[model samples]
Target: MTPGALAEGRPEARGPRFRVVVETGPDARQEIPLEGTLLVGTQVEGGLRLSDPTVSRVHLELQARPEGVRVRDVGSRNGTWSLGVRIHEVTLAGEARFTLGKTTLLVMPEPTEEAAEPAPRTTFGRALGQSAAMQKLFGVLERTARSSFSVLLLGETGTGKELLAEAIHRASPRSNQPFVIVDCGAVVPSLIESELFGHAKGAFTGAHADRRGHLVQADGGTVFLDEVGELPLELQPKLLRVLESGTVRRVGDNAAKDVDVRVVAATHRDLKAEVAAGRFRADLYYRLAVVPVRVPALRERAEDIPLLARHLFQQAGQPDFPLTEELVQRLMGYDWPGNVRELRNFVHRVLAAGDAELPDTRPVSAVTAAEDLSGLTFKEAKERMVEAFTREYLTALLARCGNNISEVARTAGLARSHVHGLLNRYGLKAGD
Candidate 1:
């Protein structure tokens, strides 16, 4: 029988007895027997250590009391939260819950043995990988899902950022509420403001009726801002204001409407670099990145390639299609510039043509598409080959280093500026 069940069946004990349940990270479902002055933080000496980066060295202290348990925030940078509201200190009892950084804590009386089993594992999605990097990412996702703080997902394109965001919503308390998706990149710059914040009727030439924006549409749930870095510079502050005050004013409207929404923003760009370059606002970055979770790029966890490829193949309606070892090797060998999406497309192409062998790595046909090299000089042909080789080499190098230019330079023994120049010259952007 579970510990909770065991505790439930036992006679009521008179002393202070409770368990602090960690609901996320590597310690999910871990129970700490509450005692006098239990310290929780990222520090090793902490009574309960949480390795999440968002957690401060010393976050909160829980002291056993006659009435219940008293939780005091130890001046944590992000602050302690309960039911989406920040609190300096509060007394908790009877299944009280709170959040510390990216971790969630549940304060409850000791469970009976029948009820003492660990929390059930949450199944996020098929795209949710089983690799170590992905497992860590999911841990952050699970923790962040329990809070209302803004989240920023950073990764290369096709790393399943949107799917991850959806998983978070599904795993959250707001799951039953509306989940609104706003593709900032897809919206026109002219209409983005109105689309996100809504507008009063007649605000613009084409305005026909008063409309609620995506933010309002997601009032009680989550607003997923996909490709959020692509949002226009002029509109960022407005977004930031909403994040700060929980109030959004429609374009050309004087009155502001309050919205209770959890914001989850994602981008392929290195937002820190964008902020450094003055393209992205520093204030906005901090507000969105309260819990920044970096989705792992495909090549980082190559061991999962077979599983992902097989899943994609099955998704393509060819579950029985043979994934030969040679084909699997080729899939794992290439640096997926476009990540999982690229791999899925490759699978589609293979299925479409019913090709039994792996496609050639080189575009030999493209080189010969001109019908002859007679019109081209040997020097030109040599230059084309050299360019292709250089571009391919750099692409692989960038993938290996998680798109960090400094790491790539250090490993290749090249100057930072030189690396940037090469990337620019070859039209190879980082985080592709």
Candidate 2:
């Protein structure tokens, strides 16, 4: 039986500051208040008693604090794991996923009275969100789409800036016209000028024929410059001239051709700092950022994770896949540093595994190739993925910390002994 909503306290005292959500097992979906030290296990005296066989009589203890919740494993035979790492005790300052035996528990701050009610999921073009951040962003996008201002989409990588750019173009007057994408970072530096502006025949070795650059190609439409911060410093003036004059001068050509194109640039870099560091031009930055809009990161809009996860799984051709409440709770607990793209990949990975319910903690680079999963059991594949991620993450961290074991442990939020144990388990040396 799960404890009641309010913990035993003075009659006039406010409600508990936190709640423990039982995500899986016999007590699945039960929300228990955390007034003080709450015991969880199979015992009848436990505040969160369960019928799950794997849970010990007195498995875990949780205490709620103003800052967060303190969780401790109380001599449980199977131990407890957060995300994917086993833990004896941890102070979780935010939403966290904990697994004991076959059961998953979510410890998080109690939702405010107003927040207890659900908000409708909102969609703008191909993007979907329901959080306040996204709602504000949608309003901004709606306003920006009505005008022809050179929009600058600012956000961390994988926050769907390009999708928003396309949304702007589709909603703008130039819907029928070409919407070109120019990946500034993907293009070769030497050819970028020729690529963006046009080149005449015999302009250079590769100019056997006249070529209209991306600006000309996108005339009467819009051009989305992904990673615009990667634009070469030498060509900044030329780009500025085009934006100001509405004309582009082909590389090695004296004449400038008229081009009526709107520009939408996106980047993860702070252009103002780039300008101060003399890496990017101040004038160009000002010109391109005529109307700046920021796409909120996934963690900033965690309320949308369950909606997004379900949508992503459906998009990956698993429309019938059961996204249990437990699965959604786990998904929301993760801080998706890689944002929506990472979440999409995780959905596909879960679809591939068929029975995976936990969030994939492995970095994007460590996600095993689909081809590699063939003929391998889920356990084997998961082991391989974990090993790859452990090596890659530790290797990067070790290099970043200059082979200092203490520094590595501190950076990774692990004890020195645990870090050493991992290094030893993987045959890695601090110096190596």
Candidate 3:
């Protein structure tokens, strides 16, 4: 074998012996693929089954090593002493000593003998973060998860409303029961009623045999209706009847069958507006929204973008990739108008089209999406930066128009009252 070759027998080659030891507990064991500064894993009984890439600056120091791998002591409570001496955390290697509380064990390159095989596939545990808005939404979800009341999830298309519905179903008592999804938007208006309420034999042109609808199939479980707002106004009454009473009549059948099913309806439409405009039935809106939830758009919680991106990236089955700080910053700062689905499509595109560096281009229009204001301190520059952005936006819109406050407000997409408030807050006159 030649020098610098992957073969171990080569002159300048090193074998895959890198390892890590986290002193968590007796049942402590975690494997994080060498990728970024933060390690991802689950929190078990004793401690977290996780490792940190940023355990020590010395780990970064070792980046210059010819082997492209290094170990260091990270400041940990239990301490990570590699080969003796009281130290913080240590970057480890194959066959290293691990200590949790008082117990000590060895970490080897070969897989350890264990009976607990991991789950076959990665499940999106749920979006987790500390934003207050998200906390409020979760609080609502927790409060309404069990009761049989139908949930109306309001959010733009691609905002993961269906995913949220699935989470609700999984958390409910009927979790073991079927979780049937019906895309109301995708169903043809003519077939929606038959599709949802089922059909008897010889009911219509396409119906030769009797068949149960999604609501019946979801009996004892959840029937998630995506794009509930798209249901035809005329068909709303029948849906309201099903929600009002736990009974559905198949097409061409005069008799109604009783069923026990939870309804979780989601849509991007402003249902209240639809009700006022007489496009949607108020009775049905009230039925679906026993407890309504508004899923915030991606741009609203920019703080969670990096966490979400890494999670989605891992879900794409790529164990490791250089999703650098700059790239994450760019993503966080960009306006994700397309929301979670757009982000997923984006990662798919990245995995398919580009390399780790990922050329200076974006999947969608290059709008100033999410601004990376994460690193700003709580005081000083952060406030100033925010003020600057707000002030400039208002000023630009005002200047574009001939000092017409109403026109400026319309063009800037601000409410008239909000525009007036901004004008007073910034101490700006009409022409000034």
Candidate with best lDDT: 2
User: 1-432, model 3: which lDDT tens digit per residue?
Assistant: 111121112233333332333434443433332322332222322322433432322221111133333433333344444446653434443234544334333333321111111222223226554455565556556546656667788886666777778888988899999999998866778999888999999998979899999999999999999888878999998887786568999999999999899889998788989887988975567557656678888779888777778788899998586788989888887766556765776687788877333223332223223555566676855676667667656654453443567656544657779889998998876655
Q: Evaluate residue 10 in candidate 1 and report its C-alpha lDDT on the 0 to 100 scale.
A: 36
Q: After superposition, how far is residue 411 of candidate 1 from its true place, in Å?
A: 24
Instruction: Give the TM-score comparing model 3 with the true structure, all chains together.
Output: 0.54
Higher-scoring candidate on TM-score, 1 or 3: 1
Tell me the tens digit of each residue's lDDT in model 2 across 1-432.
011111111121343365677767877757676767789889848498878899898998888755567889999999999868988988887456789999988775553211112224498789999888887677667656766767788897678888899988998999999999998876778999999998999999979999999999999999999989889999987898898678988888899889999899998777879887988976577567656667788888999998888888788887787878887787888767657876776676666765454434556454566446767898997888788888878865664454667657755768789999999999999755
Model 2: residues >4 Å from true position, as ranges? 1-121, 355-432
TM-score of each model, in listed order: 0.60, 0.57, 0.54
Evaluation by lDDT, superior candidate among 1 and 3: 1
Native-to-model Cα distance after best TM-score fit, residue 169 in candidate 2, in Å: 0.6
User: TM-score rank, highest first?
Assistant: 1, 2, 3
lDDT (Cα, 0-100) at 125 in candidate 2: 83
Q: Rate the local accuracy (lDDT) of all candidates.
A: 0.75, 0.76, 0.62
RMSD of each: 12.7, 24.7, 23.7
